[model samples]
Target chain A: MIRFVLACLVACGMLGSVSVCHYMLTRSPVTEPPTSIQPTLRSESALQTPHRTPDQQADTTVSPSRIQLQNNDAARRFFLILTSGFNTAPDPFALGSDGLTEPTRLSAQYGDKSIITLLNDLLRGESIRSSEFDVADTDITRGTLTLFIRATPAETDARIPCPLRIDLIRADGFPCDTYTLWTPGNGVMLTGEATLNPVPGSNTAALGWELVK
Target chain B: MIFRNIYWIFWLHLLLNSMIPCSSARAEPLFTVVASTTQIADLAREIAGDRCRVISILGPGINPHGYMPVPNDGKTVASADLCLQNGLHLEGKNWMATLVRDNGNRPIITCSDGIIPLHLDYDGTVVDDPHAWFDPRNAAIYVNNILKGLIVMDPEGASQYTARASLYLNQLRVLDAWITEQFHQIPPEKRILVTSHDAFNYFAARFGLTVRSPVGWSTGAEIGGGMTPERRRHVVASIREGQVPAVFVETTVNPKIIEQIAQEAGVRIGGHLYSDAMGPAGSAGERYIGMMRENTLTIVEALSR
Candidate 1:
């Protein structure tokens, strides 16, 4: 009789604990939007700065910084084209045998922590590859847009120099050349819409951004 | 007797807990949006995210220009929280508008609202072009209009809609950039787009390409519009004069005209571009972006060589 009473109580206790834990875990979903790309009607300054200093960019665990321009109302859209050594990853601006743009291929060819790796990471971010947009051209121009580009150091060991040329194109259509980036703590940031020239920022040797236009 | 009842209830609680755990049963979506065309349907789906359900009255490759609502289409919109249509007379003879009107005064939103329309001379009267989604920037406007309608219907999902709209807008920007870059390969002299009708004006204007189509194309009141001898002559002249290496057939338009033009012009048929509707399911042009991507690829390959 005593054992039967204890078993019932034990069983009841276990059920209660399971319910409480489940409630706690399920109720608190990750509802907050990532801080980098929150939409708001702000001054152009927000698009102008993106953790240029190394200390400000030490944490690479979160998503790369994505700055939105002007009340999240964008009249023109832009895409970045990367001209690197990887043949499989076709330059978006170039014509190849096939009609498809080969996706980015990332190997430790530069020891995952190098600038090239960081570039690949930025290009492969969710924002770069997401397919939820069905945008059309607009005639009503929004105010001047402050371009924000964030470059963070990827965790890699290889320090080999990778020469790369980068160009920027907006949806309205145009291109520019020449670029420069200041280095801090082995991290580099590129801003502006039309062109990008990367000056070596960290330990990687011979890493340069060429004018590819 | 009371003790026996207590034991039964305890086991029942355990059984119920095992099945449901901590999550409550999910309710039906916040609301349902019914769009007249697949393109607008996709826009609503993009903005709605997982918050609500979106249904398109017409299926893939069904020309919106002359879509006649079936029996089920009426039932489909009957349960809709909101109705959407591509205004500017894309819905041949106002078929979609008439359908929505009979749906009992639902909050109908013209997805093409706020677009600075591209007007074409139709029957001696200038009318706005209906195929505005071709431009990535205009696509942004369409998405925003849909977002606003959704927000009005379900205020609580405004942030969700806005956030999604931002992501989608960014994507549009990327697409626009990519399309421009792809077109850069074609020499300026060869940057001409020849299609069955005037559906690609916004796209060509947005990018650095020129579009040439037959006269009375802007007023194509029927799908795969009947080709007149004069219109046929215009198409052949456009191809020969523009030195267009290849012309494209349309998924929704009658390909017979394009095929005859391609043969008459002595140019190879490049490929069929998705204009009035996206490709059938499982095809490259299944989604809006997919359609654009495939269309650009087709155009690039045909024109570059």
Candidate 2:
């Protein structure tokens, strides 16, 4: 009787172990590690290097193939092309003291550094010029760069010097004997020899930046 | 033995059933479209409905003229099946369009196609005025171009696209008539408009208003300097000369400049106008029609005196 009871207890123990092993074998293998472990691993890797924001990464990792116009010659040519395109009496609502407003001085709105960066990016490659750049119907080839200027009282005249010289002619392609001259920086000086044509249906004129060298 | 075999078959059937959903999920197809501006994306969505996925490169308040394309924008373009842009150089140096072309040479549709483009002649050079959609009739042309492009890309949905486009076009015609009637209330002499920039030339031409601004055709061109003394004197003189009852600010431009001019001229600041971009999602100018209506109402209220 004692031997039979012992045998029965051993058999039951073996069956329980076999059932547990079978269940374990049939269970699914985890495709992903536990969520708790992922954060710890990420933290460990993150500690190995400094974190970089997306913009910083973009600024640093600009592709080598991407063309940039960093030279003074390119910058000067770009400024001339940009300045030549302004319409005489461009803004209909705002008339100059002469009853015609030439293009607003660029140096007054943007800093030299900001303007240089924008021109460098836009005029980086030869193919870039074929692309049209327009704003509010005015075609421009550059991007916006924000920089601080000497702030003055709203009513007072804060005449910041213009960056480039521009010349304007009449719609009939005649010399209006009107021109604007200014020297912004980098030893760049414009003769204001360029002429502007009237944009049809608008009081403003259009500058052909593509025709500029 | 028979009972054990039956139990094994039942488990096998359960496992096979569980795999069906996973297979179907992987089989679903997606048609991806890339649009250059939010207005284009909205139009694409109206036409595509749930049949395709649409993404806009320029979001609300982003000036398409001065927009710079990043590396991620190129990646997005590479994954797109079709691309759309408001052509005639509306992309500000055509940067957005060029970026798309450079990425994959994917099929790009210019929504401004087939419209009689307004040209601006500066000196001897003639350039196309790209802001044609300010007029509802031009907006119809945009829809037609978009419809044709969609049909060419996905002929399977031609009938659906055609139906949606027809409905939208009818609504545009109605919107155009409504604009005409709204402007009729304002006297012809009172139709003089002064705003932040020259974006309203097409709008003014369509509605019979004389438009003026201190800034050039583009706000991007205003970069050389802030308000010059000459420009300020010019605008203030024009306002006084025209006896322009009010001056308006644009939603996309800085109002400070216009405000200063209005203050100097002693005229009330008219309500904000939407140019280059539409208003936020819940605003009155959210949709194309809504934007036109809001703009017309604002103009009439300010100038109707």
Native contacts recovered, each model:
0.05, 0.00
Computed on alpha carbons, the lDDT of every model, listed in order, comes to 0.62, 0.59
Best by lDDT: 1
State each candidate's chain A TM-score: 0.27, 0.19
Q: How far is candidate 1 from the true structure (C-alpha RMSD, Å)?
A: 16.6
lDDT of candidate 1 over B1-305, digit per residue (tens): 66666677777888778667434556468798899988989878988987788998989988887667887887788889999998888888887778777866678888777667888764466768889899876787777778778889999999888888877765775687678778878999898888888899999987779987753443354533445788778778878988899989888887876777889988888998999888877998888899999999999999999
Give per-residue lDDT, candidate 2, residue A136: 20
State in Å the error of residue B54, model 2: 1.7
lDDT tens digits by residue: candidate 2, B1-305: 65556555555655565455456444333578899987788778777766678888877767776788988899988888889999877787787778787999888999887667777653355767788888776776677777777888899988888788766765775676578768888889889899987678888998799887876556675222335578779889989998999989998888888998899899998899988888888998777888889999999999986
* lDDT accuracy of residue B80 in candidate 1: 90
**Per-residue lDDT of A183 in model 1:** 17
TM-score of chain A of 1: 0.27
